[model samples]
Target: PNDALYFGFGKPPILVPKSNAIKRSYSLTWPEEVVGALVFLGSLLAVRGVYALVPFLMALGCAAVTTFLTLKMWRLIRARELSFYRFNLKSAGKLRKAGWAFAIFACCWIGLNAHSGWIRYHEVLGNFAFQKIQVPDELALAQVNPARWLNSTQRENILEGKKHYDAASRVALFVNSEALPKLAWFEYLLGNAEQSIQLLGQAASYQKDESKALSLYYRGAILNRLGRHEEARSSLDQALAERDDLILARQEKGESLWQLGRRDEAVAVWTDAVRRNARLALVNNELAGAARSLGKLEEASAHEKQADQFTPNDPFYQWMLGRRLQALGMSELAEKHLRQAEQLGAGDGMPNER
Candidate 1:
């Protein structure tokens, strides 16, 4: 698990100007200076525009370039190469002070970008841990302790029950341009449904295609939680219209339909999703309840078996299943999952538990 290679690739190598090179005074022409200024400003703007997509790498590059440029600028100042139109002790003193100020600003800029990149690296790691559940321990236990993977410098959660996602969300706000959708999800995880909705709204202008569909789906799920079934259904419909393969969107749409008194349509949607992905344990659980309500005892038993087979030992997953089942009026099954969630430390404020 040597991460030296990761650091090597993640950060740009430092460049040191050869000290043995002949010192030559290079006078800056007015036109050249103006062009250089334009190029630097343009680079900054370009980096800003694309940083959200490739945050950590862009940040590290900026840090490295800033450091290199500052060193070059300092060397020029020392060599008196930038004194093309300056004279007198007063002007010289002012120039030296300005150089010091610029140097300090560059140092701060480099440090901030490096720090942002480092934090973003942790966010990526946390995501990998959560999304890639192929680890033997996770597979065997059907659970993942995200905090054990993250071990982030910003360890304090904004909320007690929420896990390591808060750190990722916080860092994204600084270095990610396309952070709104992700922030929405994190806020939702932290139980801030209204805040999540607001972020999704803001994300609308920045997202395209699948990202837009994702935001719409998040909005739908949040609306469902807030008991706004009509709005939830509308959002979910839009999401599915854009990307029909979004299984979670289909699942939430089913929730909205069920809440709006369209039980058959909800059942149909759940059935379709289950057909597409049989491993969706929560959907199976939902279908199990729906079948039981319709007096289809054998079908209900089959769906229950599927749920039991696919459901993970993940505390958050169990907690979510419990909440969704409770909403479906499956009190017995809901309480069972909720109790299991509690035993697995879902709301006990111990996110590191296996």
Candidate 2:
């Protein structure tokens, strides 16, 4: 029949030649993968500085990158063919999985960011709370137990105090007289001797009464520790002038004098110090050594006995006494003290005979 065989459809679809048709393949190249990784890293680095200010934005960026990487990993795992680099998001199931993963990651990132912010807020509040505490209370607490000042909580309070002091200083020309010494003490405890010394000087300059005596004494003590014997002696002399009853200042002054090669003067200073406070083991110990050096054996022996009596349980004192006795040729007494020191875990190793 003349009519051509026709399908139910109005017209048949046109078939193009295979050689003339265009074919497209979607796949990530090695260079593209590397660039993606670099882009992710670069974004993180770029946002790090601003993360604290805009944590939500930072978290969003991170979540987006995480979602992308997760999707890529899912594609890799589900790929049937080897070397599969294309990420397919056309499937409803795959799209839903990606959406859920992104949502979960974003939630976690936001939660973590909120937690970090909360911590920072609490730290700031802690600082403000510490700043509100009365200086006298803090000082009395520190003085009551000097070791307490070295604890973490006290150290944090001190650091916060310093920050507050700095901020206040920017609006004023002078430091608070009472706070100066406390700040110096904080610096000393933190192992910044130079800064402590500088702060003490400021305190001394701010006040010249008996109140400044403590600052002067601390300055002298730190100078002695630093081996600036002349400066320490000068500072201690000023401290004594400010408060004549300062036995500790006298003891430290003698030490500085001894270091400066004025042995007779040092002996005199320590003797006076011991008389002022007979129970002071430190002064007694110093007097004992000074008397021994001056060939006053009887005086040395008396002071040594006094020191031992005052600090009976002190291992360092026992070790020092043993050494002095050993030097004076009292072998039995020396051995006894040395053994006591050893039992108390004082010396680094066995006491050496000198």
Candidate 3:
């Protein structure tokens, strides 16, 4: 994917003649030949990982072409014929004539890479913003400042991530789908669930491997929050089918199942998630509650202990615990954790339009 390879592949005809005719063909030294050979060897080694049949065959073809050109170069040196001296000069002159063309091509490629880097910057920024805006806090939804406990990052402590979304979306529009998942999450944080769903659908249409999975997971999450458990389960199942390692999707899917009155299924899902990643303190907490509801006090106690032991002290996990507590009608305890989390850092705080 480097520019050198891209240019070489793009103009193979030009490369063929250029590789065959070097300036001072008869003066080629052993050291220069060795270096060229080493470079070709490295290229072949790099291509060795091309396992797909068609790609492997294509690589082989390119290698064969490279070998042919290399052999031609060697032949020119070994010939030591004054006959090719004039021909070499003509080839050299052709290269000089193409100097402007090469310069233009290099400039275009550089500009393209520069723009791509800018887009990637926004994508990374959006990803960082998304990490902070994963779940909405009820307090955030109800308040203009959202995190009353935190030293406000905003003037008068307005919502947090709107600028990040705006910056990312501005550049993200140039890309087909790179920042779509984060953009969808941004919309959700702004209380635009329908718009978020639409964005997610747009992202999924790209069918990019990681992005598609993320879009499905976010869709499932939005549906779960809207109480559309059946649709949420479907989206989460598709997300998991694409990437089973998405623990958040698994957690949300369990919530969807639980909301659908499939208690045993929900327990199974949560238990599987905890088994896959023991550090999922939120899922462990869910398991603890499920056990408590089933009257298995001992099991409930064990899960609760594990949850406490494994829970991360970060703002996100603290917010998760606060939200879980709020859902359980433990408002005072929930408020305490939410405040603590906000004091540490704004947890899923949105930007206030006002």
lDDT by residue for model 3 (101-176), tens = 4334545543443444454454545555556552344334322223333343422212334455456456642434
Which stretches of model 2 miss by more than 4 angstroms?
A: 1-157, 312-342, 345-354
Q: What TM-score fits each model?
A: 0.56, 0.50, 0.51
Best by lDDT: 1
Worst 10 residues of 1 by lDDT: 137-146
Judged by whole-model lDDT over C-alpha atoms, candidate 3 comes out at 0.61
Across 1-354, the per-residue lDDT of candidate 1 in tens digits comes to: 565554334323345456745677754656656655654554444444333564546734664476456444544455543432352212433555555555666667655555555555555544543444322222111211222322232223323212334555555545442545655554554346777788886786566788888888878877877888899899889888879899989998998898889999999999999999999998999999899888898999999999989988877678667767887787777787878888887664424332
Candidate 3 wrongly placed segments (more than 4 Å): 1-175, 314-316, 328-354
| Regions of candidate 1 where Cα sits further than 4 Å from its true position | 1-177, 189-191, 339-354
- Provide the overall lDDT of each model, using Cα atoms, as 2-decimal numbers: 0.65, 0.63, 0.61
lDDT of 1: 0.65
Better of 1 and 3 by lDDT: 1
| Candidate 2 Cα lDDT to native | 0.63
Show how many residue pairs clash in every candidate, following the order shown: 1, 0, 0
Give the worst 10-residue stretch by lDDT in candidate 3: 45-54
Tens digits of per-residue lDDT for model 2 on 113-138? 34433433433443464555433322
